[model samples]
Target chain A: MKKLVIRSLIIVAIALTAAFLTNLLRPEPLAWIAGAPYNIFSDCPETAQHALPLKIGNVERERDFFVDARKAAQFEAGRIPGAFSLPYDSLFPADAAKVDEIREAAGGWRIVVYGDMPGAKLLADDLFSQKAGNVYYLEGGLDAWLAAGYEVEK
Target chain B: MTPKKEKLKTILAAVGVPLRVYIGAVFIAASLFKIYEPYQFALSVATYQMAPLPLINIFALALPWVELVCGVLLIAGFWTRANALLISAMMLMFICVLSVALARGLQMSCGCFASQDAADEIGVHTLLRDFAWLAVSLYVLLFDDGRFGADGLLEKWRKSHA
Candidate 1:
């Protein structure tokens, strides 16, 4: 039993050594955990800025183009008037043609994305990364929008 | 030997090697992806929403190494019973997590042998598959005779030396 414990410890040590070596040698170091790239929400003026928070009043006053970045079912259930649906879950790095389409349609007008907080932030970051100008996100999503007495379009 | 006892021994002997190899190979293969892309594995672990946020990264970093060590030990037949117990314990944890996620209607990847995005979605099939692996681990714990392994050879060498 003592021998078995020692052998197991030796094997575990070898495994840990192998993992440490491989991670050290890899070209692109992985983040210790998964998260958005730190620079995605840059405060620097040279690069794109962090997503601006767009309130319901500003959305109504400006009549800016809105992009709903929720799931399809959520978008179908209710949304802001004249809002274009762009389900965030389906958008991948490789296939972002829909984003391009929305950019083209907006014609450089301010775009406001709203949905679940993380999804909204992700989509807003993606748009900013793609050089979309004047991108913003609705603070607190549809629930907040409704609470602020904004009308929903079915 | 009695006929029944002989038949039972024959069955165990015939099945033992394949079962150990299957469990070992599966664990090794599964550990490779988790070890290589630990950040992705962390994301998959987070999808379960069970672990506290601070520990997710720790769990992701350590779990794959444990799997790899146990897998190598199982294949070498060194400390076979202990390794089998570890593997069985992991499978039981997996079964519990999967059950909870399914009951809660959380649609996320199984994170079994792949990164979160690339892995198959968690469902009843995943639960069933884990249960099957758990059974295999238990069988290995009970009937492995240490044949065709370094453990048997080590014992022989020690006895001769003594």
Candidate 2:
């Protein structure tokens, strides 16, 4: 039993070594201890970085347009009222033409993109990179919207 | 040797090697993506809504490497019992997580393979698949005597040298 324990420890040591080595070679090395106070700014675009709270509230109604960065099915099920569907593709990186199409339709207003997960941030980042300066992603996606007592529009 | 023990050894020889290799190969394959994309894996783990935020990164950083080493050892047939035991424990953990997530109606990806964005969504099928793998690991732990693959070769060498 002692031998087994020793062998297991050896295996663990080897595994940790490999993980550390590979991580060192990565372009964006992960912080071993996460939840850093500034982690929100790490992947966010330069514009999003200055947004302070990062999460847009109250949908902005007629003044701002909402973009659903999730699938068409999810968008159709329920969404912020009068939101446009961009349906971010999970299988592929953000599509340039699809994002352009959404941008064109939004007419230079404040565009708030959202998804069930980080897809919204991904789309918002892409849009902001393409010079859509007014783009922002909803915090925590649709769930956050509902959590804050906001109504969904079927 | 007793007849029953002989039977067990034969069972190990016939089934254990192939099972170990297959499971080991799979684990190695699964770990490769997670190892390369730790940040994405961390996001996937977060979506499960189970692990505390502070520790999700730890699992993201370490679990893939553990899987890789165990897989390689299992395939080599070195420390066959230990490797099988570890695999069984991981499988049990996965089973419990999947069950709890399903019971609470969590809609998320399994993150079993590929990036979180490209992973198979969690569901009953994934649960059954994990259960199947767990059974294989249990079978190996119960039957393997380390008298095959690298372990057997090392033993034969030790006897001849002695």
Candidate 3:
């Protein structure tokens, strides 16, 4: 029993060492272990302030360009009127051309991205990181938008 | 032994070997994705909203390595029972998390494999699949006689030395 336990420990140690070595040798190690400091949602009040509720009155008053960051199918099913479809997953660093297209369309207009809350936030953050100016996200997403009786275009 | 009993044993042992291999292979395959994309896995874990913020990274970093080691050990037939128990525990933990997520109505990805997206919603199907794997792990824990592995050979060598 003791021998078995000892051998198990050794195997576990070896496996972990291999994983550690793999990470160490990688060009871009996993972000968490690489000790990269990330700004949590709470730390960025200025960014959070950019997130707007789906109140129809507020939305109607603003001249912001809304970007639907949901999946293609979801965007097609229904979205805010005049909102352009840009799936969040496709917004990779390699997709600079697509980002440029959105930026061009916005053309100094405030970009309001919305989908699912988490996904919208992520897309907004990605856009901010890429220096997309005046980007905001819709809090609580399309569900909230619908709940607030805002008209959606099919 | 009676012929009927002997036949039953033969059938069980045959089933056990393949099941062991299947479990080990699944673990290895699952671990590989997590190992390669620890950051994504961490994000996935965070989506569950069960673990605290600080511990999510720790779980993400260590879990794939544990899975890999146990998987290899199970395949090698070395410390088969212990490895099976470990696998079973992991399955149980997964089952609990999935169950809680379902009950809480948190629409998130299972995060089992590489790609996690809005479409990868958690449901009863994920729970059922993990439960099936859990049953297999428990079978290995109870019935693995160390046959068809290095453990059998080691035992043989020990007896000869004695």
- Give the chain B TM-score for each candidate: 0.86, 0.89, 0.87
Residue-wise lDDT of candidate 1 within B1-162, one digit each (tens)? 999996787578548778988999999999988988877777678656787766776677777988988888888887777787778888999899889888998643211222324234667888999999999999987777565576667888999999
Pairs of residues clashing in candidate 3:
none
Candidate 3 displacement at residue A153 in angstroms: 22
On DockQ, the stronger of 1 and 3 is 3
lDDT of 2 by residue, B92-116 (tens): 9999998998899764321122233
DockQ, per model, reads 0.11, 0.19, 0.12
- Which is the better candidate, 2 or 3, if ranked by lDDT? 2
**Which 10-residue window in model 1 chain A sums to the lowest lDDT?**
A37-46
Which is the leading candidate under DockQ?
2
TM-score of each: 0.54, 0.60, 0.57
Q: Candidate 2 lDDT, tens digit per residue, A1-154?
A: 7776687778778888988888888888897877652221122234344221245443455555677888888888999988888876656655677667766766644567888656777777666767654576778888888888878998
Worst 10 residues of 1 chain B by lDDT: B107-116
Segments of candidate 2 deviating more than 4 angstroms: A37-154, B109-115
Q: Tens-digit lDDT track for model 1 on A1-154?
A: 6764675566667766776666677787554554542211212212436566766655532436788988889888999887889878644741368777777766655678899988887887777677655578888888888898878997
Best by TM-score: 2
Task: State fnat for each of the candidate structures.
Answer: 0.20, 0.39, 0.20
**Interface CA RMSD of each prediction in angstroms:** 10.0, 8.2, 8.7
